[model samples]
Target: MKILIVGPSWVGDMVMSQSLYKRLLELHPNVLIDVLAPAWCKPILERMPEVNQAIEMPLGHGQFSLSQRWMLGKSLRDNHYDHAYILPNSAKSALIPLFAKVPKRTGWKGEMRYGLLNDLRPNRKIFQFMVERYVALAHSKSTMLSEVTIDDIPNPALNVDNENQLACLQRFNISPDLPIVGLCPGAEFGPAKRWPEQHYAYIAKQLITEGHQVCLFGGPKDKSVTEKIVKALSEHQKSMCFDLAGETSLVDAVDLLAACHTVFSNDSGLMHVAAAVNANIVAIYGSSSPMYTPPLSQKVRVVDTDINCRPCFKRECPLGHLKCLNELMPAKVLDAYRDLNRNQNLE
Candidate 1:
């Protein structure tokens, strides 16, 4: 079987999409799967062993360039894929596969995509995990199987290269002498999801004082926030903190994160990337809930509070005060980190 998967745009969603690819592989061991996603996600899809190839989606998200879609579709005619799974709910995301003339197009009922998807699956009961919803579309509409009903669903496991990890470390002038604690302090979604920077500096100080090396992680956009975290620290603490927010590429970040003993992150894309690489992780949640998109790793400790206004699911907090994250405090995450360390040692 030859399948073309229209992957989700976000880093976390694309990582979780591996469950669907793995499911397809299990059903057809000799199947060939190719993912069409944003160019930024190419590095991630490259690490999933089940994928046969990665096709870069030339157009940006929400872009409806009919001529470009038609041109790209025309280019793929010879491959003759058997199936196409549209991971995104937008009507625009379905256009390529339709233009490609794939026989079976599968997706959830979304955005009035009436005839766009021939094999449509309705999300009647809201799925608990985003992975669950993505995995369900791997089956036909009639079979109706999903991760919710399945046993032993595989979590995303990104393949790591030791050589690359070594190179990344050397490029950054980093040493493995001390235990590494990676701090991912930026949330691309919005500030509502971001824990206070003062809280992060406190964690960084505590870790550095304990003789652990702390590295801050984020994309180019997060460099300022990461800088704030580093600047607030003591000179010695700042020396221990490696600010690589804008310095490294996503693939480089993945390799560097693989060398870490533990990671502390807000509910963000790098959090999921950290999880996929099997980093010992403590994922902090503020506006988001773990039930929907928890980091897919066994070694993770999710730190969230039972605040009434939490899990708002908005890009930014509607209420001016983000008490959900502010009141959760640094001590709670520190306690979770300590427990995770104890468990890892016992193991």
Candidate 2:
């Protein structure tokens, strides 16, 4: 079986899509799965054992570029893909599969993609987790996603690059000598999802005081936020914390995260990556609900409040106070982290 997957754009979504690829391989052991995603996704896709190849998608998200899409799609015809699984819902996402003339193109019924996808699934809400939704498409259209239990689905596990891990530790002057605790305090979604910088600093100080080296991780947009967290720390605490935000590539972060003893994170891409790397995780949820996209790690403690206005799923706090995060203190996440470590020790 030769399959082509039009992968999702976001880091978390891309990580979760591995479940679908794993399912495809399980159903057809000899399947050759090639993912078509943005060039940014190449590093991630390369780490998935199920993916045979990672084909770079030249166009950016929300870009129509009809001529470019046609050209790119036409270029893949020679691969003779038997099936194409489009992970993104955008109508533009399906154009390549259509142009490639794959025998079967599968995806959820989304935007004006009626004719674009021949094997379209509906009622996407039936599946709760994003991973489940992606994995469900691997089954026949008649399959009931609701009937699929969480344990039945495969959790994404990214293969750690040990060589790159050593390189990153050396390049960043990170000491693997002491236990490392990583902090992912940035959320691309917006301020509503971000936990207070002081809260993160508190957690970092606590961890460092416990003799753990702390490393902060995020994209370029999050550099300033990470800086604020570091500034909040005392000079001694600052010496123990490595502000790695905007410093490493996505793949480098993945490699380094795998080396951490634990990770304290907001509901962000690195949180998902940490889960995939099997890091002990303190997944702090704010405006976003864990019910939708919980970290898929057995060694995770999901911390969230029962604030009524929460799970608003807004980019910014519509209520303005941002109580969902501000009210949920760092002590709670600290307790969760301790509990996670306790469980790990027991195991």
Highest-TM-score candidate: 2
Model 2 Cα lDDT, one tens digit per residue, 1-347:
89999999988889988988888888899999999999988999999999999999999878899999999899999999999999999899999999998989999989999999999888788877788888888888776555455678889999998999999999988897989999999998899899999899888888889888999999999999899988988899888899998999999999999999899888988899999999999999999988889898789899988889989999999989999999998888888888989989998
Q: What value does the lDDT take at residue 238 in candidate 2?
A: 86
CA-lDDT, candidates in order:
0.88, 0.91
Q: Which window of ten consecutive residues has the lowest lDDT sum in model 1?
A: 144-153
Q: Candidate 1, residue 139: CA error in Å?
A: 1.8
Show where candidate 1 strays beyond 4 Å: 145-151
